[model samples]
Target: MDGSSTTTALVKAARAGDGDAMDRLYRRFAPVVHGILLSRVQAADADDLTQDVFETALQRLHELREDAAFPGWISRIARRAALDAWRRRAPFTGEIPEAASPADSVESHRDAEQALAAIRSLPEAYRETLVLRLVEGLTGPEIAERTGLTPGSVRVNLHRGMAQLRERLGLREHER
Candidate 1:
């Protein structure tokens, strides 16, 4: 069967309590979810939240109204999980990661700072779409499938986000 058909079968079986199908689903979507979480969350937190997302999807799979849209349902769950992780995080202004080398870390540190600042500055829709596209490496259709966005919406978000990123970086041209 083709990939789409395989995914449909997996979703149906997973909803029917097939452990192997659930495992397949986990393998299929975990990277997409993890990529979305990595930008706004710490890697460790992203890992934990990824598990929570899949577990939640598995437990609630029976409630899914459309098996063909399982990826979008799971994406919504992952986004919510990441946002929750951010809300629970303590406010801090210093470097997010511990630094061992002061002189050697300047460039790397600045890059991180710039990325975080750019992400925070974008509108909510733009930010999520950017992270999913840029960091998660998801295609427009994949993101649309996962996030329940129309493909056109994804394109608009990506365009707006690239414009904002270019503005933030003082670049003459947009990049996505």
Candidate 2:
């Protein structure tokens, strides 16, 4: 079966109280949800908000009219959760917090953080798309599938967002 058909089956099973199906759904879509949250909230909060979004989706699964609409529906939940989180967020100081694990090289961690910040600085459409494509490591088609964007729109967003990100990072076209 095709991917969407498989996803629809999983959603149907999940709605029927199948725990394994729910687990599989979570595994498949968690990155999309997390990327959505990251587009609107701090990275540190995105993980927790991702969980919250899924919990909310699961609780309201019966309200979802179409099984195939799961990706877009869950994405809307993630956006709402991220907005709520942003509303409740503590005021940011100028200081950037270190989020590196011990195994990560300091320079690489810093560079990653800087790149993420640049991505976040983009317009909302570009920001979310880029985060899904870049940070979440989703392909253009996968991003389009998960976010309900047309393939053309995803391609345009990726192109423009990359250009803006490169400008923000002072990188030439050849550098990438």
Candidate 3:
């Protein structure tokens, strides 16, 4: 069977209280959930929230109506988990807290986190696509399969997002 068929079978077994099936599903999708959470929250929180997302998905598996929708379903749960974490960390006063950090200003960590910050500064469409591809190590087709975006859209987002990053980092037009 193909990946989606295998995923659907696993989801079915998981829904029927198959612990091994759930484990398999978790093993398959953990990085996806982690990537989604990491895109929204800090790394430490992302790890914890990744567990939270899986636990929540397992507990609520019976509520999922279609196994084929598993990717989008779990992705939504991951997004919600990140949002919940964000909400818990904030005061309830209906105000948005700033997302900037002192670390972003230092620029000392020029390897990984700095690039992440530059990617984060892009518009949401670009930031999300870039994060899934770059940080999560998902290929363009994998990103589209998981996120329910058309393959073309994912390609466009990655291309446009990279261009913006090049401009921000002072790369010459020819360098691209």
Candidate 4:
């Protein structure tokens, strides 16, 4: 069977209380949920929230009307988990100053950590799209396919996200 059919079978088996099928589902989608949470929260928080997302998904799996919609559904749960964590962190929002850069300018030029921080600061649509593509290694088409977003929307998000990342990184438009 193909991926969809396999997922459908797993969903059905899981819904019927098959523990192995549920484990399979968790193994298959944990990375997707982790990537989604990592885009919005700290790495440690993302790891915790990824587990929360899957736990909630499993608890409510029978309520999922459509088996094929699991990806988008779990992604929504992951986002909600991040939001919940944010609410728990603080009731108010304030900016934190950036830390001092390293002395070695050459090494700093390709600072992936800084780039990831900038990506997290982007608007939700762009941040999620970019993280799904760049960090999670999903292609534009796969992103659209999994997230239930239109191809055009995915393309636009990627384009705008890249533009914002370039500007934030102090790269010229032509350099992109």
Q: Which candidate is the best by TM-score?
A: 2
- The weakest ten consecutive residues by lDDT in model 1 span 91-100
Q: Provide TM-scores for the models.
A: 0.79, 0.90, 0.82, 0.79
Write the residue-wise lDDT of candidate 3 on 1-176 in tens digits.
Answer: 87788889999998888999999998888877887777677777788898999989988888899898999899899989988998888522221123434344344444355566677678877877888888788899888777767899999999999999888777896865
Local accuracy by lDDT, each model: 0.77, 0.85, 0.80, 0.80
Distance from true location, Cα of 12 in model 2, Å: 1.3
lDDT of 4 by residue, 41-76 (tens): 766677788888888998999789999888788889
TM-score of 1: 0.79
The stretch of ten residues in a row with the least summed lDDT in candidate 2 is 91-100
Q: List, residue by residue over 34-145, the lDDT tens digit for candidate 2.
A: 9988877777788888888889989999999999999889989998888788788873332235643667777877787788778878998899999998889999998887
**Order of candidate numbers by TM-score, starting with the best:** 2, 3, 4, 1
Clashing pairs in 4: none
How many clashing residue pairs are found in candidate 1?
1
Position 22, candidate 3: lDDT: 93
Query: What ranges in model 3 sit over 4 Å off?
Result: 90-108, 174-176
Quick one: best lDDT, which candidate? 2
Task: Please identify model 4 stretches exceeding 4 Å from their true place.
Answer: 90-110, 173-176
